[model samples]
Target: MEDIIDKRMVDQSEMSYTVDILNKGVGQVAKKLLEESSELAFASVEQKSTADIVHEAADLIFHFLIMLKATGLTLNDVSEELESRHKN
Candidate 1:
C-alpha cells in the first residue's frame, strides 16, 4: 500500500478521489482521518462484529498515510519513532 501511494503521488495522472483529497493538502487528509476515527469509535461498541471496526480502522490508516505523506513523512519514519519509544 505504501508503495502504491508513493508511486501514485508522483505520477498523479490517474487521480482518484483519494489522490484528489491528498492533493488538497494536509487538512483534507486530517479531515478524512477524523471522520474515519469517529466511525471507528462508534463501531467499536455499537457494531456487533469486528468487521465494522476493521473497515473503519483501515480507512483511518489510509488517511493517516496520506497525511503523513503530505507532511513529508513515511511509515518507516513512524516505525522508527515507535522503535525509539519502545527502547526508552
Candidate 2:
C-alpha cells in the first residue's frame, strides 16, 4: 500500500516567520541593536563558548548600525556617551 500526501492543504502564512517590527524609516536600526543585545544576553545565560560569544558580539555591533540607521543616529553619538562615562 502507498500513502498519499497533500501539499495544497498547507497554509504557508500560518507557519512561523520573523519580521522586523520597527518602523521602516527611523527606528529600524535601534530595534536591531536591541535585538542583538537580547541575543547576547541569552547566549551568556546559555553558557555558550567564548568563540560563540565573540561572534554574537560582532553580530550585535552590526545590528547596532542598523539601529543607528533607523534612529538617525551615528557612531559618534555612542562614542560620546562612552567618553562621558569614562570621565565619571
Model 2 lDDT, residue 1, Cα: 5
lDDT of 1 at 22: 81
Q: What does candidate 2's lDDT look like per residue over 1-88, in tens digits?
A: 0010112113333331111322344455555667789889888899999988898898887566555544556677988999999999
Q: What is the lDDT for 66 in model 2?
A: 53
Per-residue lDDT for 27-53 in model 1, tens only?
878888899889888888796478878
Question: Candidate 1 has what TM-score?
Answer: 0.90
Superposed model 1: Cα runs more than 4 Å off: none
Candidate 1 clashing pairs, residues 3+ apart or interchain: none
Candidate 1 colliding pairs, count? 0
lDDT of each: 0.85, 0.58
